[model samples]
Target: MKVGITGASGYVGQFIVRHFLQRGYTVRVLLRNVQKTKIFCAPDGRFEWTCGDMSNDVVLSEFVDGVHAVVHGAYDHLPGRYRGGEGDNLTGFLESNLNRSLALMQLAHGAGVEKFVFISSRAVYASGHLRGNLQEHSAAQPDTFYGAYKAAVEAMVSAWAYQLHWHAVSLRLTGVYGVVNPLARSKWYDIARAVVRGEEYSQGRNATEVHGDDVARAVELLLHEADARGQAVNCSDRLVSNREIAEIIQSISGERGPLPPQAKAVSPAVMDCAYLQRKGFRFGGVGRLRQSLRELVEAVQKEQRSSQ
Candidate 1:
């Protein structure tokens, strides 16, 4: 099988690429800068690359050509933030992120791709207090432009999958954690870095998160599983607070420092992944999380030492 993917250099995309390569598939990635290919490719698998982004039609047309599946993960957003990713270029953001993505979808369909996976976010659900588990069927009430765009794309994926007779799924992900490499930081990088330095930092909040590897697994499941076609599945592990992460950081670093205090955050809702659970998909829970964070801490230590 050949899988074509955008955002191959991204945190989660890196994991998806690695996982797909490990599964004995020829992976083709679309990238504006091809220099990052070294970060992803291994000796055991065949990896191909395209020098373009979502905005380029000719590139996109050729990118999706002759692939079994498409995984779209690229997003043009402000650095380190999604809600206000548009910054001052609202029109540009819409053009690149939303409009061009729709173009990619159509191209994939035209080329007879067997499956498509759109990486949607949990931000599609309305912000504020959630009364119950965030089900996949929950009505999308996006509060940010980022969430709104994701919700819109998901709706299009579902509708198109139905009409085109293809296996398509939108994996609604929460905060994706775990590392691509020791130098490649995932979620919670800063907190872990701060703990490695034994410095005082404040990020007293919690969020629903999942390992990047598991997110990749969800993508793998949705591609071939008949039950996943045209479905929106939630992919979340559990709610992890900053304080708990700090304890793990200290434990791994053996720095023995005071932890961050528990502060109020607009968090607490956990996405219900009943469909994934039913599929016997096991997430790497806290154990894997700890291992990843420990690597992050050690990476920070290495950087610190190199600088000194």
Candidate 2:
């Protein structure tokens, strides 16, 4: 099966591409610049990339020409943030993300793709909803433009599914974590480094997080799942706190710096994943996180030593 995936060079997209390749699928990636494909693909040496912006109908159509499925994870945002990623240009943000995304959906549907998997975000849920037990059926009241855009595309995915009469599942992902490569830093790289360097980290944030590999597994499962059609399923493994993160880092790096203060008792939106669980998808909990963090911490220490 040929799977055409967008955003193959991104931090999250790298894992999805690798997972599909490991599963023995013919993976063709969509890239804006054809030459940039060498940056990531050279390592695996097993990718067929379609070079051209997805906004260009000719290029995108060529990409979806023979693929059995399409996984869309591309996003244009300001560096280091997603919620307020628009920064100064709301119109540009909407035009680039929402408009182009809808176009991709229409083109994929027209090209007779069997399945469409949209990488949606948990940002679709507002902070109010986070206070409760969040489920796939939870109502979405997106607070940020980023969330609103993702929610909008998700609605379109379902609508397109009705038109296609086949599989389309929006994996509403939480804070995705893990290191795909040394070039790509884990989400907790800075925090772990600060704690390792014996810096006091008082401010700690907590959220539901899943390993990147697990997110790919969810995508892999839904593609083959006969029952995963026209539904938005929550794809999160467990709730992770900043204090827990400090402890994990300290345990590995042997940092004696004070572990981050206990996070206050706040209602964290723990995303319910009963659907994924029933589908026989197992998540890499803290154990997997620790292994990934070990590699990340070692890299951080190596960088710190080299700079000194």
Candidate 3:
């Protein structure tokens, strides 16, 4: 099987590449910068990297040729930073994220790619607070521009699957972490560092955590599982409070920070993974969280030592 992934150098994209390689699939990564691919690809040269942007018709066409499946994991939304530069604000974000994704989907279809897997976000649901468990069929009310863009693209994927006869799977991911680069700061790493320093960390009311490896595994399963087609699965593990997450970070990082005062408890936006569970998607839950945090801390320490 040949699988092509957009944003192959990203945290999620790199993990997907690793997963596909471990499963004996020939992987191709679509990256704008060839230099970035060097950091992720194995020196054995088992995988191929194509240089191109998703919005380019010629590039997108050539990138998906002869690939069995394509996983759309690239997006422009930097977790805490605004990436879309000065322009029609909405258009810039949409072009970089949603429109580019749609174009890639079309290219995949034209190239006879068997399956298209999209990594969406749980933020598509309403923002106030999740009153109950969020099921796949729940109403979507995205509050942020990033969430709105994901929701919009999801709708397009669904339409193409049903009307255009394309096989598609959209996985609404939540709190994917475990990619701890000393130079880069993800939400999880930032929170961990803050807790380690005994600093007060303010975060959004709705957040859930999932290991990046686990998320990649889930996507792999969805790609191979026949029943996953034409379905939107909500992917997440246990619902952990912000305070609980902070405590876990402290415990794993050996950070002796004082716990922050309990702020107002926010309603949980828990994802209903019943469908994934029924499909035999078993994760280590909070244990996965702990293991990921420990790995991140060790990685940070190692990098610090090397720098010194």
Candidate 4:
């Protein structure tokens, strides 16, 4: 089967490309710039690249043509926070993300793609203190522009699936950490860097973490499994406090810096992935989390030494 992916150069997209390639599936990556593809695809020549921007209908249609499935991972963040009286940020985010996603959906449908997988966020659920496990059918009250945009897209994808008879899977992902590019800044990276630098760090309340490889594996499982169709699954694992994560990095890196004092600890935001697991999707669990963090720390240190 041939699979097409947007945002093929991103942290998540790269893993998906590699996952499909290892499984002997033909993969086509939609990249705006061909040069960017060379950097990531240099290690392997298994995947093909199609030059196109998501906004271009012609390009999108061409990219999706003859593909069994398409995974939409591209998301554009607004210039400013989508809060307060200034609704401009929300407008920009919707135009770039929601609008682009809708266009891509239509293009994929027109191209007769069999399945469409959208990587949504866990933020779509109602925000407060997550008192219990958050399931797929949980109430959602997106408070921010980013969350609102994702929620809207999720609804759009579901509607499109019903009307077009297309298999749509929206995976609501939590904090995904793994072997991302060293240059990419994530919460995990930030905490790891602080530990390595022996700098003071502050822990935030309510942060959930998941390994990127586990996320990639989940996507792979969904791609082959017909049961994942027409369903929205939450993808996450056990929650870890920010300070605990920092300490883990320090331990793995062999850094001798004194662990920062624990800040206020808040209730963990639990995302239940029971539906996904029932469909035969598996994660690396706590072990995978440790391994991913170790690999990330080693990669960061290696890059740091090389830079010096």
Candidate 5:
């Protein structure tokens, strides 16, 4: 099987590519800067690299050619840039991204690909907090423009799936952590470092999180699982509290700090992954969270020592 992935050098995209490659699928990645992804430039010929952005028609055309399936992980929203911040031109950003996304969907459908897996976000559930629990059939009320756009794209893909008789899966991801993406903002890393430095720590909200590896695995399962087709499922592992996260970081890094108080007596609705579990997808959950934190801390320490 050949899998074509957009934004293949990104944090999540890289993980998806690695997962597919590990499963023995030939992977092709679209990248704007091939030189930055030397780690994936394997000589074994299992991975192919195409250099271009997602907006290029010629590039998008060649990307889906002869591929069995395509994973659309490419997105342009940067933190604090296009999320309706002050002086942010969110309208322009949305217009551009929506155009690109719709075009890609059409292109992939036209390419005779077997399946298309769209990496969506849990933010699509704008009133998810109001509901005691989030479910697959729950009404979507996206608060932020990011959430709105994701919801919009999901709807578009679903429509195409039915209208065009295409197999499509949208994985609504939660806060994805684990494995260091140097350019990405990882709250887990921030908390771990605070513990390592013995700094005062506090958290504003508690939320669910899933490891990058687990998310990749979910996408892989959706590839062959008939039950996953034409479905939009929440892909999350465990409900994580801020205080619990601090404790886990402290324990794993062996760093003592002024930890925050235990999370308030509140059982918020966790993103429901029961659907995924029933489909025979087992998640690593919080059992491996500490080990992942340890690896992240060790990597940080190694980089620090090398720099010094």
Candidate 6:
């Protein structure tokens, strides 16, 4: 099977690409600048890449051609567009991501792709206090433009699949953390460094998170399951608090510093992946988060030693 992935150079996209490649699937990556992704492109013949902006019709057409599935992970966020939670550059962000998303959906449908997987967000769920349980069928009451845009595209994709007979799966993901390379962003590292330096760390709001590899695994499963068609499955694993994360970082890094105070009792927003579990998908996000953080500390130590 051939899978075409947008945003293949991004943090999440890289994991998805590696996942499919490891599974022995022919992967086609669409990027804005292929030259910038040299590290991601393996010499292995199974990977094909094209460089073009998503707004171009010719690019979209060429990308979808002969691909059995499409994974949409393209999102554009402008600097200072979002402050607090609401966005200020609503129009620019929407035009860049949402419009292109609709266009991609239309193009993928037209090109006879067997399956389309959209990387949606858990923020699509009602966002106020983060107290309620979120399920696959939960009502969408987005609090931010980012969430609103994702929710809108999810609806559009589902409607398109239902009316046009296209197989679609929208995986609503939460915070994703993993470190495959130096470019990988893992918040655990930041906290560990801060603790090691005895610096004051910010105690921010907490949310459910999943590992990036686990998210890619979910995508792999959805691509092959016929029952996943037109389904929006929650991809989050477990709710983790900021204090817990800080403690874990401190323990793993063996650093004793002014860690942030324990977070107050807020209603933890736990996302239900029961629908995905019912389909025989076992989640390893929360279970492996600690191990991943430990590995990250080890990687940092190794990098420091190599540099020295």
User: Could you tell me the TM-score of candidate 2?
Assistant: 0.92
Residue 117, model 1, lDDT: 94
Please list the residue runs of candidate 6 whose C-alpha ends up more than 4 Å from where it truly belongs after superposition: 41-43, 79-87, 305-308
Show how many residue pairs clash in every candidate, following the order shown.
0, 0, 0, 0, 0, 0
Cα lDDT listed for each candidate: 0.86, 0.84, 0.77, 0.76, 0.78, 0.80
**What is the TM-score (0 to 1) of candidate 3?**
0.88
In what order do the candidates fall by lDDT, top score first? 1, 2, 6, 5, 3, 4
Residue pairs with backbone atoms closer than 3 Å in model 5 (clashes): none
For 1-308, candidate 1 gives per-residue lDDT tens digits of: 99998989887889999998988889999988878888875544478888988877899989998899999999999887878899998889889898988999999988898889999999899877675698888799998889999999999988987887778889999998886654635677778778878787676887788988899989988888997888989999988898999998898889877788896766678889989999898998989889888878887788889989
Weakest 10 consecutive residues of candidate 4 by summed lDDT? 78-87
Q: Which sections of candidate 5 miss by over 4 Å?
A: 39-43, 80-87, 127-129, 183-187, 261-268
Error of 5 at 206 (Å): 1.0
The alpha-carbon deviation from the true structure for residue 119 of candidate 1, after best TM-score superposition, in angstroms, is 0.5
TM-score of each: 0.96, 0.92, 0.88, 0.89, 0.91, 0.91
Tell me the lDDT of model 2 at 175. 87
Q: For model 5, what is the error of residue 37's alpha carbon versus the real structure, in angstroms, after optimal superposition? A: 1.7
Task: Please give, for residues 1-308, the per-residue lDDT of candidate 3 as tens digits.
Answer: 88989877777777788778887788888998888866664636568878878768998888899899999988765455432222357777788888889889988998899999998888788766567788898877887777888888889888888887777989998877766332355446666667655677776343576777888889888888887777788888766666776788787777766664555666566789877899778876778777777776666566656777
**256 in model 2: Cα distance from truth in Å?**
1.2
Candidate 5 versus the native: TM-score? 0.91
Which candidate tops TM-score?
Answer: 1
Candidate 6 lDDT tens digits, 121-177: 887876667676787887788887788888999999789878887889899988877
Q: What is the alpha-carbon lDDT for the whole of candidate 5?
A: 0.78
